[model samples]
Target: MNSEEVIALAEQGILTILLVAGPLLAIALGIGLIVSILQATTQIQEQTLAFIPKIVAVLLGIVVLAPWMINHMVQFATEIFANLTKFVG
Candidate 1:
């Protein structure tokens, strides 16, 4: 493939990664921020205190978003596969 095609493929790969991971990451970030605030206010300095909630939040986010995530991934894969000849030639 030419440079442009390579770049386009790279871009699509990155976009797919972000689309798949963004929600779970955002949920974890939000949960971590809230837990940090609560810890600050309550003076609970246990580092592990934030871990469980963040894990649960990420898991819940994944569970809730699994179908959508899978659909997006499948669509991306389909697009790539549909263009397989172009990529190969």
Candidate 2:
């Protein structure tokens, strides 16, 4: 396809990726921030202390958000596939 079409497709793909990943990343970030604050207060320098909560939060986020994420990804994929002819030709 033309450069404009290719760029549009790339933009859509990026937006889809961000939409799918944003929540989980936010969860991890929030958990990490909290853990950091707790560790600072407690004077605990254990790396696992920081790592475990972020992992758990991200997992829980995934579990909770899976359906929504899947729906968005499916919609994006469907749109891309449906427009494949236009992209290719």
Residue 15 displacement (Å), model 1: 0.7
The lDDT per prediction is 0.95, 0.92
lDDT, candidate 2, residue 85?
Answer: 88
Q: List, residue by residue over 8-57, the lDDT tens digit for candidate 1.
A: 89999999999999989999999999999999999999999999999999
Candidate 1 structure, TM-score to reference: 0.96
The residue pairs in collision within model 1 are: none
The parts of candidate 2 lying over 4 Å away from their true place are none
Local accuracy of candidate 2 as per-residue lDDT tens digits, 59-87: 99999999999999999999989998897
What overall lDDT, based on C-alpha atoms, would model 2 receive against the true structure?
Answer: 0.92
What CA root-mean-square deviation does each model show from the true structure? Answer: 0.7, 0.7
| The candidate that achieves the highest lDDT relative to the unseen native structure | 1
TM-score for all models, in order of appearance: 0.96, 0.96
